[model samples]
Target: MTSAISVDDVHFAYDDEPVLRGVSLSVEQGAFLGVLGPNGSGKTTLVRIMLGLERPDAGRVELFGQPAETFTDGTRLGYVSQHSTDADATMPVTVREVVTMGRYAHAGIDRLNDADHAAVDDALERVDITDIAGRRLSTLSGGQRQRAYIARALASEADLLALDEPTVGIDADSLARFYDLLGELNDEGITIVLVEHDIGVVTEHASTIACLDGELYAHCETSAFLESDALERAFSSVRVANAHRPVGGD
Candidate 1:
């Protein structure tokens, strides 16, 4: 079977500053991959390159066997961005309406047909937010809104889902539920890629883990990652720095 995502010797830089260097990894179909790193580690930049939002300076990216640049199957990949939290809360759109927008990629000139409406309903049901489908986005709690966003991505019937910093600002209970939902989606054969900060939680949940710190630190199964020297090196630097801090100094 073809890999869901493939990045070969990828390199990226911002002006004179390099972010990613010789990074290469592949995610298989139905795999749940968790990408972990500190801030400014190029995690976001790597994501943009995968989604074709930004061009890589070197190497190549392929999505489902097609080059990222030439791939035009918009409906095949679903994306839930970190900025969803900041969506204009005052905008008076219902949950169902927001989810329905996922179908816009395939809607063409005609408005939502029966299939589109059915898809919206199905997505809402899958996310267990059918009861609140009519609620305004701003009226829902944090978890509910996050579910609605995931439902919107599902409305596209995408096989690959990518979420960036999805659990930021969410309560523990909500974050647990959100992760459960992701597991369910992955169980049903949707490949998942999550960029996250919580190392323990991500390592516990993800089938595979990829570590980055302006470079590829490690990419391995969760079990192997625990014993890998790469992980030690990655966090050892942080530990050494923290140890040197003066007790009363900033």
Candidate 2:
């Protein structure tokens, strides 16, 4: 099968400090590839290279069969950043208007055609946010706002979705719900690259795990990675002796 993303001998540096050292990875289509690392571990840099936002000093980055930036004209690339906050909800923007902006990346300066309109509607529906399509974006709850962003990503009509720390501050319910969407999207053959700090939770949901600590330690099946000690070393911080669970458990 054709790979969704390929990073061959990729190395980058921010000033004199080296971030990535000869990083090479290939994410298969329909595969959910997770990138786990600590702060300043080149996780964000690597993604930036993939998105054509930053240039790598050496090696090549490819999407599909061609260079990442040259993959296609105006294809969708969903990105949900880590620092997103719901505190800005009262900005006086409607959900439809916000989601519609996702199409701007693909639409020409002239006007949106029929297909673009259809894509916008389908994207909102894909995330099951059609009911609130007409509602104000600032009025939605935290979970709903996050889902709205997910819809925004979908509106990109992207063949590939790359997210950075998507579940950082979300509640347990919202986290679970968002994860369900990731699984559903992956099931539909949408390629996903999840750059996350916590691997314990997402490993079970991903098809492959790329354990990164400055370099790729292992890229293998989730079951194998979890069963071994590598996972612990890669994701040591996420483990809590007593996790905060909901009261009166089922």
Best by lDDT: 1
Root-mean-square deviation of Cα positions for candidate 2 versus the true structure, in angstroms: 6.8
Q: How many residue pairs collide in each prediction?
A: 0, 2
Per-residue lDDT tens digits for candidate 2, residues 1-250, read 7787889998888897777888898888888988876666678888888876777889899877689767665555778777655544557776777778778888768687888789889978877789998888777776667677777888887878988887765678667767888888888889998988766766868888887656766788888777767655644533221223355858
lDDT of 2 at 157: 77
The residue ranges of model 2 lying beyond 4 angstroms of the native Cα positions read 85-92, 131-142, 233-250
Q: Give the TM-score of candidate 2.
A: 0.82
- Give TM per candidate: 0.88, 0.82
Residue-level lDDT for 33 in candidate 1: 95
What tens-digit string does per-residue lDDT give for candidate 1 at 42-88? 88899889877888899999999999989998888898877664564
Q: List ranges where model 1 is wrong by over 4 Å.
A: 85-87, 236-250
